[model samples]
Target chain A: MEVTEDIIREVEKGNRKITLDLYHYSFNVLMSSAVRYKNHKEDQMEIVNNAFVKIVKNIKTYRPGTAYFSWIKTIVKRELIDDFRKNKKYKELFKIRDSDSVQESVVEPEVYESMDSESALQMLNVLPPATKLVFNLYAIEGYKSKEIVEELNISYETVKWHIKQARKKLKSLIIENKISLKQ
Target chain B: MKEEKDHIDDFFKERSEQSSFEVPDSFLDDINSKLDVLDQKKKRRGGFFWLWTLIPIGLIMMYVLWPEDIEINKTKPIVSLENQETNAEGALMDSMDEQKSESILISDSLTEENITQEKPLNDTENRSAEKLKSLKNVLQDDVKKIDKLADENNPLWLKEEIKKQEVFNSSNSNNESEIVPPEVEEMAIADSNPEKNIETRNSNINATENAEIEGSETDFAIDENVNNVVVSVDSLGNSESEDSIINNEAFEIDSVQIDSLPTETEDQDSTLNVEEVDPSETMLAGGNREKGDKINHEIQLYGGVLNSSSNLILSNDSSTFPMNTMESNLWSASFGVMYRAKIKQLDLGAGLSWMKTGEKANYGTNTLEMAEVDSLIFIGWQTDSVFNQNTETWSIDSIPLYDTTTVTTYTNDSIFYNTANKYTWISIPLRFGYRIDVNEFSFIPRVGIDLSFATGSNTGTYAEIINEGLTQNSSSRFILSYALQLEVRRSFDRWHVFVNPYFRTNVTPVISSAIQIRRYNSWGINAGIGFKLK
Candidate 1:
């Protein structure tokens, strides 16, 4: 349903159901973009809040007919990037590995059967930011490596390399946890 | 592998699962209450704005529409007082004329009865006596009526009554035989309205008698009264002609009195007169006097130590030529004194300033950075300029550079560097500026031409490089520079404390033998504190 002034009024009047509904809609859109970029739920909440403040403050600047979710998604992505820059952690997390000059091998399908959904996500969180973003955009969001390179302003080779590294890291994390469980 | 794909896809799906976001109930309540207070404040402010605007408008409308009625109300009493004064003077004259006519009638009656009543001695005398008694009775009765009318109608009756008492005392003692002649009496009787004439003549006679008795006591009063009457009559007849002459005489007398007054008293009284004086003329005189008192003087002592990394006088192009990093922080202080004369708001000044800037830098790439460069530029400039709060334009010309430096470096495993780069030159900086001021703080942006003339023989080893510097290649050339300067100052009495920040750019090429060693531009930022004493 379209949100109107009446919905805002109802929300302001302590109508829990309506306020929660609208908030959930905005939160879902923002969380999807944040996880796609960073693959970690730990920092996702802070990034989403920052994006939410920007959206609320500059709501008038948002043009309708354009994709509302994507517009909010871009803000979440920018906020994450800004946070990394401010902390001086972007270089460490995204630095290209010397060995991964070309695309690395993708994880085999057999590996997925061994882990549940929750375990798989736990493994994805441990992957580095560049690897995680590349994997999410390529495997999950169905973006091509060339498109990812254009969007992130990196070389096509860098995109291919990040995805391969992500798969290797996730597969190793699952295998290491499995061995621990067996022991 | 298919199961692995399914697990990864399920992980993404699980991560994407959205949770509801709920705003705290207290936050909305707090915002609504704050908004209510804001609305109240806004309403109050809007009311105040309209109230402020309406009061002056109402006052102005009242002044414009009601001025004529207000003026008439003020002038009405003054007009009435003038009329009262005029009427009093006319009544006094009329009474005096009536008194003269009455005296003549009395003399005529006395003479006519005396001539008619002459018979056998005793009888004739008795009849004459009775007629005289009857006439005395009529005169006494008429006098009583006049006294009653005077008491009821006249404000000056008390003074008149005192004069009448004096007249009665003097006339009672005067000669009794000066009675009216028959021919004169006949002429008086022949007048058309004899009875009225007789009464008027009796009043006139009584007035003459009063005048004679009280003449000494009332002389000043009578003279003043007569003069006022004559002036009032003349004024009424041809007021413009008479008023001009009277006003001129009055003005001359007033001026003499004013001139003789003490100057201090006149000055004190001038404040009172200011309201009375024409507003436009007073404003003009006040403005001129203030302008005449305008004076300005400035003294600046700006001394600071500035440390900079390099003497690389080239613009930084980060993509191409890397910065020649250096470590040198030079400290310099300058003292300047300026005296300005202001004509109205315009200021003209001349100032002398002295400054010394020195720097040392390591030149060449990392392996070749063994060479150290040292230099000093001593600047002495005398400026002639004009400045106001808005704008300033100045011309400065003086000997600028006297430098001594040594450089040593290894090239191809052998030492090669210039150790001397000392020389003197004159630089004239003609600057034009505009400033914007907030409170007393100002931002001044300036553009200028730096004209340099090499004065002496190039003594430094870097003279070759200097000759290779574009403008220095010629004996004289121009360098364009743009600068933004901000001066923050607080003026206290005659002294001012100020901090100035200056950023300057050079826009001319540096050349040596048609080869460019340094580019034509350089940028520097300097901050210093200074005081103004005037």
Candidate 2:
């Protein structure tokens, strides 16, 4: 199940059992990509399944010397973007819209101290698809506004708006969840 | 805990933490199972590829071998007419030769009862002469009533003469006796056979008997002059009495025919005799150029294989599907060659075709932000389902000040997703249309209903191939469609090369519901040759 030259070769040859084994072994390595690009309310399991199918389909085109996990991550990102682009929910996210004073809700780091990473992910899942994507890109992936605009094909201001909205939604989710925990 | 106000930007910049969520237990198994199912489809399509070749070829061979005009040519003798006959005597000899070999049935009648051949026609003796004289006297008396043989050039006159000569030769073998009786001999043959007149009377009695008699023996006696008695059997007289029937041969033998009539049974008698059977119009039904010419009907058979071009109406107004669809080379082909007849300038025809056709389009609901929305955009897809937004207010008084806040709830409206819509239809088309052959090509525009009995894919207005594989559309539906068929034909002897372009449209929608309606319209061209099996 190790990501090796022979394993990659067998997967490329369309050995179904080997493909399944490789998928199981590489689950943890691929999970982050699936989570990062996953849209709000979309099933992470379904995304993983779609990503695995695409991986197997493109196995023949995979370069042996290249980083296998990166290749898989790239496919996962594409699948998520495609999933968002195809749906009617998030198509307008990158378009030019009114850039005005957004309602901002900021929280202190002390609130996140007691919060588990699982809780953080669940909170991130509540943001609208474009806002979530922009937040992941700007905060986690560390892409600048211009890079985000070029990569996501969005106006610079739209990306900033998404970042702001994402923070507000994340703050709200954290506050609501913390209150619920206290209750 | 007292909350500290920090910019949302600082909160985002502060975190670079990994998230942990438990993946589903059977997640790997689910992907593998789906992969297996999708893989099976690829295999099945591959398997059908070879069948595509063999199936159409087998169908073409079957169509080529089917009997189209076979029955028309069966009765014509294999022997050449020139070799068989030179003059009137030779013609009689030919008819006699046919009758001798065929042993045509004249069942339970005159020759069946009274005219017993003590010996064959070869037995030219005194007793045979006496018998012939007696039979001749009786036959002439009956035939005397049919005196229309007054014209020597007439075909009926010749039938009458041949009948008398055969009777004479059966009675005695003399070359001079063969030449002697022209009209008188026919009168003798016609008049002498009282039982033949009686049998004719019986066939005349009913419509059923008329069909039976035509089936039994409707041979219009062909003479040496090739003059044929086109039997006006009803003209002969349907009366039960022999006297009235005898009187009716006044319209005597008007039509002419030589090919053997297809009777159900044959008489065992080896002598050549005119079969006195019923009368119906059997002139044209027999297969031959001669029989065909008399009827004024010509058969035109065409066989062609065509590839069709069709499209799926993905959206009501081509929003998802623009005029130029990013299409692959996915098309369908059909082979069906029909038979048409030229009735002067107008041609009428019908044909059966085996068609495997489909319409495919990839349609997705692109996220449409009415005003570039970031807040959960809630709006109805249509006019009717407007979401009811209800608001309630709560107020909290702090530091001797009162503040009010509003909470609004919005209804859920359905959103569209990206779907790869694909539908495959296998239909059997039964088409009837009018064809016009101008110069080398014929245009046949047909209107008929096609039965789409087997299919797979999306059942909506169009098939949507979503990010998730193809939608299952398995149920069969009837589609009304029309075809503007163009054919280029080159005929060689009895064979021809037919290239028909099959263009068809569905008048009815491929998928229709209360909200949406879609149609499968296509234009395709197929090229193949076919044979005429006559």
Candidate 3:
């Protein structure tokens, strides 16, 4: 069923069924980007539940009849970022051992067209944590390069490099999967 | 270069547009637990607020009912006490009677008319209780002064009464409440036999006997003796004054008004406005989901029979089956999964499906001719007579080049051959449809595009039109098709049973050539059921 303003009000009040439905919706929406370390067996459910807890706590701050999804997405993203900040692996993934690591070329544009959304998301997650975060913010989440730079607190070069690496990683994965451009 | 980059962006856009996704089942349980916690918190908060609200009301009641700053009148009426103990008892009886009068005033004040209307708020009900209490205190004070008043003359008692009646006089001037005003009290006493004034004093001698009936309206049993004194003195026949004292049952708990009634309509109007209480107003345990969950695409699996016809029929005889098209009444079955979206009554879908479009057709002739023969010509009889000129006497000399009994034989007779053009394609269809519901049934009308690509195909007789004369073999295998369908569906729980009748025509000819290509139009009537799995 389509969620409406009234539904959102009910959802806020902790109406069990409506809240559950709303949570499931939020979980699915943010899971792909939020649960980055899929191979590490990171619990997407736990991350989403925590995000929901935050959402419930701050639901009153949300304006009725406003863009609820965008507001929720922001909260979910923050929760994911908090998780990343807490995880030691996330820190290691981005720590520069040397300043001169090889940077790959931009991915072939046709590669994205070829893969289905599920496979594409999986491929997207395979990128290094910093690169995946930058790419998702820029490409899927519609954040600008400047905004990402500020958000990640990285220099312009590193930000651009991460975006490039994310694309290259996806392009490589597409080639590995042997899928071609399909309409 | 820019266009190529745009293509990449478009790819990402399309991929990201697939936002309607599935999640793990346990997430729902997590949400449920969070909501339960939220509900518990909400309940606690609500109870807390209610408790807080009650405190103020409770405090106001206490403030009104508290026995605060009650002072007794010191100077007393110089009435002679025949016996000291009996005067004390009479004083107690008068106090009890005043208490009853205070109750009646309280009840009168609490009526709906008084509560709702504010003009009369501080009228009879407001000061009557205070006056009654003051009157009770005066009776007590009078008892204490009885010994002193006893020393004075009996005539001085009435004169002293007249002299020190300032409070009663003030009550008559200030209060319009039912407890008798001074004028009425005086009139009742004046009409009374002045000879019975002494009798009035001794009649309430038993007032102190049963003062134990406290906090009860039925203290009327003890109040009767006191009432007789007033009733006998009330000889002016002013029954209303008598009724006032009789009706004044006084307070069961000595309650007092905490606040004045609000006279304005605005407050009442505001109260009415606040009644639209949201039943679902709950303190949320978790964040709310955005209202952007679209009509999500579902994975649907449906299989049914279909009949299809195409321009490319394989036939030995080319006239009836022009361009060697695929014939009609060809029953074929198909099954495929669709990314389906249902919006209210509207149903939308796109899917990849495969089906064959052909059946075996019969045309005569077993002979395989390299070049097709056009026609056969007959010779005139005069042509053979040229031979007769040379032999005028040699009559009919073998009809010249052809003799009289000449017979011509053709190559071969047409045979009953069985051959068919079987073509199969992987078709992708996008449909937009609306469903109308009636009871347990729904009628759906739909229109969409079908892009059919050749996946597995057999050329049939089109292969037969080879190098000898005709040589065009279509290399193009993609077809852009359109369809119209009507589906009647019956839903049962999460499963739906439907029969869809559809007609499809390829916008791009099945035979893509600009030349004499025939268009393929096909119809399918499928009966299938789909389970809703989200």
Best by DockQ: 2
Off by over 4 Å in 3: A23-27, A35-42, A53-71, A85-94, A103-112, A179-183, B1-13, B67-534
**lDDT, model 1, position B148:** 59
Q: What is the descending lDDT order?
A: 3, 2, 1
TM-score of the B chain in each candidate versus the native B chain: 0.28, 0.37, 0.34
lDDT of 3 by residue, A46-68 (tens): 77777888887677677876777
lDDT of 1 by residue, B256-325 (tens): 0001123322221111010122333223311222322323334344433222212334433332223233
> Which fraction of the native contacts appears in each prediction?
0.15, 0.29, 0.44
List model 3 lDDT by residue over B353-378, tens digit each.
77766655554323423222223233
**Residue B392's lDDT in candidate 2:** 45
- lDDT for each of the candidates? 0.42, 0.47, 0.52
Give the per-residue Cα lDDT of candidate 1 at B502. Answer: 52
Measured against the true structure, the TM-scores of the candidates, in listed sequence, are 0.30, 0.40, 0.33
lDDT of 2: 0.47
- Lowest summed lDDT window (length 10), candidate 1 chain B: B250-259
What DockQ, between 0 and 1, does each candidate earn?
0.09, 0.17, 0.16
Evaluated at residue B437, the lDDT of candidate 3 is 88
Comparison by lDDT, 2 against 3, better one: 3
CAPRI accuracy category, model 1: incorrect
Alpha-carbon DockQ of candidate 3: 0.16
